[model samples]
Target: MELVPFKDTGKAPAQNFTGDVYVTSIKTPTEPSRLTAALVRFTPGARTNWHSHALGQTLHVTEGVGYVGTRDGKVIRMRAGDTVWTPPGEEHWHGGTATTFMCHIAMLEASAEGDPTTWLEPVTDETYQSAGN
Candidate 1:
């Protein structure tokens, strides 16, 4: 057994996200564990760029309100204690609501080559604000 000390990774790059975002690596893949987990926090209106996981991803909301936007014009609102699952290879983005800060524990499995995610273009206002914007 071992303890993983807390570390602040700082603001997420604007190229990959919008607004203020921070992440704390929780657990990374190892020889015996392929699970990758992180604590992701977002300030009001902050969000991730479109991305997908090789083995899908699970998000367990821990604070505030947010929205999970999918490529098919779906924007699902989320709140603390709520959980959502994104299927493998499905393009999507998650973020805090316009008026609230939000945080979630994101979990996914590393791929065979240890690459777990593929990030794509940023979600545009036409697709992120709402189903049809």
Candidate 2:
């Protein structure tokens, strides 16, 4: 087995994120490997846009508190050591709570086209506020 080199941390694009978020690539698809993984950090009030994966996604929280929410209004409060899964094609968003920072390892499989995620519109302030503290 070969050790993977560390990748530089990068800001999650504003086009797909709200507030401040950082991502460090942990694993990227190589020949015969469709898996992709990253360590994502979110500042207070930071969050992802509504998006979905072709093969579902899993997140394991490493620090602080956060919320994982879906189109059906289901929301899960996640804390350190918590893990959550979103099934394929289910629109969802996740991020730090308003007063806490959150970090999680996100894992998913890439689609045949090499893109795993389809990002939709930004979650509005109203929608975010509704998520509660």
Per-candidate local distance difference test = 0.88, 0.95
- Poorest stretch of ten by lDDT in candidate 2: 124-133
User: What are the TM-scores, per candidate, against the unseen true structure?
Assistant: 0.92, 0.97
Per-residue C-alpha lDDT of model 1 across residues 11-111, encoded as one tens digit per residue = 77788998899998888888778998989999987899999999999999999999998878777899999999999999999999878999999999998
**Residue 9: error of model 2 in Å?**
0.3
Q: On a 0 to 1 TM-score scale, where does candidate 1 land against the true structure?
A: 0.92
Where does model 1 exceed 4 Å of error? 131-133
lDDT of 2 by residue, 77-122 (tens): 9999999999999999999999999999999999997699999999
Runs in model 2 lying further than 4 Å from the true structure: none
**TM-score: model 2 vs. ground truth:** 0.97
* Residue pair clashes in candidate 2: none
Per-residue error for 27 in candidate 2, Å, reads: 0.1
